[model samples]
Target: MNLFNDAQSRSDSFTLDTAIISTRVYLVLLCISTGILISYTALTPHMSTIIIKNPPKKTYENLLKEYQSTLECPCSKIAILYGSFVSLSPVYHQVCSSPFISDEWIISSQGKSFTTKDSKAIQSFFIILKVYCSLTEKTVSDAWNIFSQSVLITSHTISNDELTIRTTDSLNQFESKTATEFKRISSLIQSYVATMFSILESNVQFAPYQSVNNNSSVNFKLMPTTQGNNCSCALNNECLQIITYPGVTIYDIGVIYTVPT
Candidate 1:
């Protein structure tokens, strides 16, 4: 009876050991399967989608009209000033046709006190105007209109809608000048743009007048031009993007300028 009991006990112990080993093998297989699934998931690439938003379309006429409106500011008035005729310089005209505007941002006496938010808004407007001025087929007169309009917009907008200063008749005499006189006025305007935005000053390469020939008038061209995606002008911090609607020609500067007849 003792011998039989010992044999039965050995058989029971073997069965238990076999069951334990089987469980361990099952656990090892489960771990290997889980690890393989994790590795496969990591190696796969998921598709991602992005959406872009754009601002309202702004035009020279709309901006001009906005500035031309009456303002309550006693210190500000709106006036029209025209620069002298740009001579018929084909090369210069070709340059003008390209979209190019000043990139400098030198704050004026008035601009120095602007709030940070106001400054950024005004800067954004300035950038928009610069690009617009460069892209449009504007003569000196056209450019002046756009510039003056922009000035008024900025002045009024930054002033918290209180007052705006426009070019009243006080500066009419300054605008009408002989080629020589106009050249000086142009220089001042150019200087102002350069002082504020460093872009246009360098791009405008002027051909000084030649006294030997009456036909020789001061001519200028826009340079350092780029095209396509290279022409995108936006502040790094801004979330806005510019989209050229289908059928619209996106203008680029530094390509070609035309001399006015």
Candidate 2:
């Protein structure tokens, strides 16, 4: 019985020792695994990050050359109008605003023999001039709006001087085109007006002009003189001479009309 008890105690002791050894081994493996996990977590972020030392600076010219047409810089104000940058104010013929074109002047200028047809024709002439001026301004404004819509700024970082330098040729071309268009329209208007009044020949006698000392015959004068003082219509179509009629103090910068000779 004593031998059996001793053998049982030895067996239990051996089992406890084996269990302790297994527990120690498991704890050591767990410690090793936790250390590895912590190391991996600490290194992951740094592994993905990249650092550059003393990078070279890039210039606009160099970048433009490298990227060619594929490069683009965003603008803060993308939908700006041309009027914001440019102002187009047209100066109309002085006659349009002068007292000579007024209703009072027209009525006072008429003689006793002045027919209704003659009065109507004169009024219509002034009206045409005023309309043309208004239409020309509107047409140019619309053209500028369309041109502004088409313009694209490739670089937002560029200075105003640099942008102006780059776009000078394009702006000049647009101005030339606009001027050409204005000239064409002006020519058309002049031709139309001339044709409409062709029936009234230069030699034809109108109503007896009482405005100038009760003159019996009214002479329609056609003076082909241009603006003086280095005025070239080719360079500027608006360059016109101011004409003053006899016995009138106010100067009339006439577009189509001329002073009586």
Among these predictions, the greatest lDDT belongs to: 2
| lDDT of each residue in 200-233, candidate 2, tens digit only | 3221234433445457545554433234776543
User: In candidate 1, what are the lDDT values of residues 74-132, reduced to their tens digit?
Assistant: 22434222223112221233333333234434233124444443443445444544543
Q: Which runs of model 2 end up more than 4 angstroms from their true locations? A: 1-84, 100-121, 202-261
What total of clashing residue pairs does each candidate reach? 33, 0
After superposing all C-alphas onto the true structure, candidate 2 shows an RMSD in angstroms of 17.5
- What are the lDDT scores of the predictions, listed in order? 0.40, 0.56
Candidate 1 least-lDDT 10 residues: 232-241
Off by over 4 Å in 1: 1-11, 54-261
**Residue pairs in steric clash, candidate 2?**
none
For model 1, the local distance difference test gives: 0.40
